[model samples]
Target: MSIIGKCIGATVMAIAGASMAAGDPTGATASPQALALLGGLATAVSGNLAHEAYNKLGDKFGPLIFARYPEIDRNHHIIIALRLSHLDAVEAILRRFNESRSSDHDRERQEEAERVSELIKTYLREAKRFQGDTKGGRALEEREVLAALPKAFETALADRSGATPDVQAARHETEAQVLAELNRQIGSDLPPLFIRVFSGSESGQDGWYDLFVRAAASRLKDDEAFKSIWSAEQLSRIVHMLSLTAGKIDRVLDGQVIAAQDAERRHDEQIALQRRILETLSTEKGVPASELSPILERLLGHVDVPIADVPTVLANAVDGLLAKSKTLVAIHNDYPEIDRAINEARNKLKTLDIEGALTTIRSAQERQKELQKEQLRAEARLHFEEADILRPLYDHQGVIDALRRGIELDPEKYWQWCALGDEYVAIGERREALNTFNTALQVAQKFSGEREISVCYDRIGDMRQAGGDTAGALEAHQAGLEIARTLAERDPSNVDWQRDLSISHNKIGDIRKAGGDTAGALEAYQASLDIRKTLAER
Candidate 1:
C-alpha cells in the first residue's frame, strides 16, 4: 500500500489483470506476489524507489528481483518496459509528490516535523498546536500518538493549556501516538536521493572501444595504459564482438517481444537477466563516483557527463549502478546458467523446434559456430571451391521469410541471403534461386576479389545445374575456375587461395567428364591433382 511499492506491485497487478483478460494463467492470481514478480520480470528493471535513489541500483536490482521471481518473466506483461527506465518518469514522480503536500516542506518528504504540516492540513481542520512537515518511511515507524495525526487536524475548542482535565488528557494521548509514527519515520523510511538511467547503444566494453578508438580519440591521450595497449585491429575486434552481443540481445528481445513460441517463457529469460544484474550490484565493491573514470561513470550511471556536479535527479542513478555492476559481474562469472539459457533459446531458433534445451539462448554462439562449421564441411564435400550452403531451420519458405527479415536489418550480411537461395532450390524455383544468387552476388561484389564473391559464382552454377542448363552451368563453372586461378596467381604463397583454385579445377574436370570430354577431363584432373600435391608439400 506504500506509494513507492505501488510502482512495483501496481505494475505486477496490471500485468496479472492483463493476463486474466487474455486467457487464464494456470497459476495466475494463485499467489499475487508470484504473479507480480512475473510482471517485474517482463519489465526486468530494478526497484523504482531504488532507481529514484540510484541509477545503478535499478540496473543491478531489476534483473536481480526478476531472477528471484523467475515466474514473472515467463508471464511478464510489459513489452515496452525494456525500452523504458525508472528515470524516465522521475520528474513527474517528484512533481506529483511535491504537489500532494499542502503548503509544506520540500517534495522529497524528509523530516517528521514537516509531515505534521500535511497531517494538520488534511486530517484536522485546525490543530492549533500543529507545526512542521514530515512523511514516508521514517514517519511510519513512530510509536507516539502524534504519529497518527495527519496534516489536517481539528482546532481545539479552547486553548489546550486552559482546557478541562478530560479534554486535556484526550489531546495528550492523541498527540503522543501521532508523534510516535512521525518520529519513527524520521529515523526509518527516508533514503538518500539518486537517479537511474538506461542505455542500449551497446554494453560497456563496446562503449569503451567506440568512444576511445572511433568517436573521440583525444580522450585516450591521458591514459597511457590504454594508449599503450590500443591498436586499430584490436579495437575493430572489440567493436565487432560488441556488435555481435548487441545483435544477440536485440534478436532475443525481438523474439520475446513477439511472444514467439510459449511467449511466457521469454519473460523467464528477462527475469533471469534482472536477477543476475541485482545480485551483481548488491555484492560488488565500488569506488567513489567522483574518483571513478569518466567513461566508467557514464556506463555505470547509465549516462554521459562529468560527475562533480551530480544533479539531484541524476544522482540517484549514478550512485546505484556504481554499487550494482560489480555485484552483477561477480556473481554471474561463477554461474554460466545465463549462457546455457541463451544457447537453448537460439537452438530453438535454429531448429524451429522449441523443445528440451530450446526456448532459451543458452549457447547460441556456440551453436551458430557449430552450424557454421557444419556448413563449411558440407561445402567442402562438394566439388565447387566456393559452394554456398543454405540450411534453413524452418521450411524453405520460412527460410526465405527469415532471410528477408535478416536482410532488412543488415544488408551487409550477405551470407544470410546466400543461405536463402537454398529455399528457392528446394521448391524448384530455379529462377528465384538464380535471382536470389544474383542479389547475393551484388552484395558480395561490394567486397570484390573476396572468396565470398567467388562462391556466388558457384551459386550461379548451382542455379544453372538445377535448371538443367548443362551448357550454362559448365560456363559458370569455368568462369568461377578462372577467377579462382587468378586469385591464386596473385597470392602464390597463400595456401587457401591455392586450395580454392584446386577445388575449381576439380569441378571443371567433373563437368567436362560429364559432357563426354574425356581427354579434357583427364588433363584438368591431372593438373588439379599436381597442384594440390605441391601445395601439400609446401
Candidate 2:
C-alpha cells in the first residue's frame, strides 16, 4: 500500500484497539473464546478480503471513530465506503450530514440552503433548453438564456426587502412563468434526473433536495458524457446562472424572515402597551376614575389601537389630569374665601340694585388701593428710619439700601432719589453715582422744578471731573448751565438760581482748560466771569 494509505490504516487500528482495551471485561486481556474466534476470522480473510473486512469493521464503529476524531473530512469517509463497496451508505451519510447542517435560526446555513435550491432550478432550465433546440441552434439559444438570467436575478433581488404583498406575488408569478416556459420547451423529453431533482412534490423533511442538487452539479462537472455534449462556455454559463440564482434566493428569503420578525415585534409592543395602560390605571388616584372610563373603553375596544397611537392617547390623558389637579388644589385652598365672595355677590343681585352693587365694588377697590399705599408708606418709613440710625455709625451701604427701598416705594419722590445719588457719591462709587444722578434728573424734570434737575446735572458733572472724564464733565456741566440759565431767566431775583448758573459756568471753564482748549477755555472762563459778575451785583 501507499505510505498515506498505510498511515490511515494504522490510525484506524490504533483507535479500535484503544476502544477494545477500554471496554475489556477482564483486567488483563480478551476472553479465551473471543480470541479463538478472532484468530479463525483473521486466518480466513487475506489480501482484498482482509481490507474489505477492515472497512466493514470501521463502518460498524463509524460514530465512535468520528466521536474520537471529529476533524476527519468527507474524503476519508469516501475512501472507507469505496473500500467496502458501500456507495449507497456514503450517500445516506451525506444526506444526513446536509440535513443536520440545515437551520432556520442560522443565517449562513439558510443562505446555503437557498443557494442549492436555485442551482437545481437553473440546471433543469438549462437541460430543457439544450434538448429543445437542434445541434446547429444550440449555441445561439444558450447565449440568449445566459444573457437574461443575470439581469432577471438582479431585478428580483433589488427591492426584496420590505416588499409589499403585491410585489412579492408578482415576483413569484414571474418565476412560475419561467418554469412553465421551460416545461413547454422540454415537452415529454424531460430527463428523469431533472424531474427527480427539481420536483417540489416531495415532503421537505429530509433536506434531500439540496443534497441531490449539490451532488448532481458536482458530478456533471466531472462527467465525461456531459463534457462531450456541452462546450466549456456553456458549462461555465450554467455555473454562473446557478451562482446568480443562489444569491437571489438568499436575498428573498432573508427579506421574508426579517419581515416576519418585524410583525412579531409590533405584536409584542402592542401587548406591552396594554400592560402599561393597566398598570397606570391601577396606581392612579388623582384624577377621577369615572373621567378615564372612556379611554379605558377605547383601549379595550374590538378594533385594537395601534402601538404607535397609544403614546398620544396617554399624553392627552395625563394633560387632562394635570389641569384637573390645579383646579382641585385651588378650590381646596381658597374654598372659604371664595364662598363668602360669591354669597355676597348673590345677595346684591337678589336686591336688584345693579348700579349700587357696582359702586360698592369700586369703593371697595379704592379702599384696597388706599390701604396698599399706606402699607407701602409704612414700610418705606421703617426702612428710612433704620437707615438714619445706621448712618450715624458710618454705614453708608445701609443708608443706600434704605433709600433704595424708599425710592422703590414711591419713585415719584425726587428728593429721596437726590439723597440716594449723594450717598452713592460719598462712597466713591462714581459709576453708580453717575447712573443714579441721571435717573434722578429724569424724575426731577418730570415732577420737580429746575432747582432739583440742575443739582443732579451739577453732581453728575462733578463726578465725571473727579473720575478724569473731562469731555463727559463738560457735557454734564453744559447741561446744568442751560437749566440754571433757564431758571435764572424765569426768576432773575432768585439769588440761588443766579449762584447755580455762576457755579456751572465755572465748572465748564475748568473742564475746557483741563482738556487743553486754550481759546475755548478762555471763552468759557470769560462767560463764567460774566455770570459771576452778574451774580455779585445781584
Candidate 3:
C-alpha cells in the first residue's frame, strides 16, 4: 500500500488491490507489448527481456506502470528507485519521455503520458514538501502523505497541461483516471476532510473549496468551463449550501455530547441524594455507618442498575430491615408515602400493570407541561402585540426586542421572524437583517408556506441590493418572482397575490437595471406593468 493508502485506512488499499486483481488485460501486467500495439509505445518495451523486466517491477506501480511509461522502458529499476524514494529517477524518466516525443510519436499517446507524468511529478512534489528537502532521501510520514496526495490529485484535475483541444481532452481523461486512483488511495479521509473543511467560520473560500470544485469539475469533465461558472456569488451559494449541511451535522454531534453529559450529571446527583438520605437515617438511628453503607450501595452504587428497578430494590431492602426490627418500622412511619409509592410500583410490576401504575405521575407531568406551554404562549402573544404597538411609533429597537422575544417563544411562527427582520432592516443592520430573513425563509420552507417564503426572499434580495450585490439580489428576487408567479397563476382573482406578483417583477427589474442589463430590465419592467394593468382593470 502507498503512504497515503496507509493514512486513509485499509479499505482504500483493499479496493485498489481488488481493481488490479480483477484483471486489466490491456495493462502492462498482461504483456507490455499490447501497450505498444494500443498506443504506439513500442519503444517502451525494447528487448525480449521486456517481459522479464515487467515481472520484476513488482506490484508497487500496478496499472500506473502502463499509464506512466510512453517511450520509457518497462525496466524494474524505476520501481526500485521509487521504493528508495529516488525522486531524481522519476524526474529523469519524465524528462526522457517528453524529450523522446516527436512528430513520429502518436500525439494522443504522448499527451496521455505527459498527463500521467505530471500527476506523478505533482504528487511527489507535494509529498516531498514535508521532508524538508527537494531530493527524496526519506519516505513521507503518513500524515504528510495523506495531506499531499489529495491536494496533488485536486491540482491535476484543475491543471490545463496543453494548448491544443486534443491535448486538453487527453489530459481530462487522464486526470479522471488519476483522480479515481487517488480516490482509491485516500477515500477514507475525504468525508472527514469534507466535514472539517465545510464546518466552522464563514469566510472566503479556500483550498478546500477548490478541492471539492475539482471533484465536481472532473465529474463534468470540463475544468476550465466549470471554473468560469464559479463567480463570487456562485461560490458563496456553494459554500453556504455545503456549510449548512456540515453545520447541521456538527450541531447534532454537539447535542449528543451535551445530552450524555447531562445524563451523567443526573446519575451523579441521584447517587449523591441516596447517600445523603442513608447517612441521615444511620446517624439518627445511632446505627453504625458501616452497616448502612451496604444498603446505599445496593440502592445506588451499582452504576449498571436500571432506574426502573430502583423502586423495587428499595422496597425489598426496606421490607428486609423492617422485618428485622421494630425500631426500623417506627422510623419508616415518618416516610410512609415514599414506602407506599415504592410498594405500589413494585406491586404493579408484579401484576404486569406498569402503565397503569405510572398513569398518575405521567398525568401530573403532562398537566404541568401544558400549563408551562400556555404561559409561554400567552407571553409570546404579549410580545408580538408590543412589537405591533412599537412599529407604528418608529421605535425600531423596541420592535426588534419584542419580536425577538416572541420568536424565541414561538420559533415556528415565520411571520414573527419576518417582522423581526424588518425591524433589523429599519435599523440599518444589513447582515443581521439578512440572517434573520434567512431564518424566516428556513421556517417558511419547513412548513411549505409559499407566501411567507416569497416575502423572505424579497427581503433578502433587498438587503443584497443595498449591499451592492447585484447578482445575488437578482437571483433572490427571481426566486421570489417564481413563487409569486405560481401563486398568481393559481388564483388570478386574488388581488393581494396579483399585487405580490407585480412587486416581485418590479424587484427583478430594479436589480437588472442597477446591473446595466438594460434588455433584461426592460423585459422585467414590462411584465410588472402588464400585471398592474390587469389588476387595475379588474
**What are the RMSD figures for all models against the true structure?**
31.9, 34.5, 23.8
TM-score of 3: 0.41
Top-TM-score structure, candidate number:
3
Model 1 misplaced stretches (Cα beyond 4 Å): 1-394
Give the TM-scores of the predictions, in the order they appear.
0.27, 0.34, 0.41
Worst-scoring 10-residue span by lDDT in model 3: 39-48
Clashes of each: 98, 0, 0
lDDT of 3 by residue, 97-140 (tens): 44444332334565665565566567657644542222232222
Off by over 4 Å in 3: 1-371
Assess each prediction's global lDDT (C-alpha) against the native.
0.45, 0.51, 0.52
Deviation from native of the Cα of residue 538 in model 2, angstroms: 4.4
lDDT at 523, model 2: 85
Residue 80 in candidate 3 has what lDDT? 25
lDDT score, candidate 1, position 318:
41
Clashes of 1: 98
lDDT of 2 at 419: 79
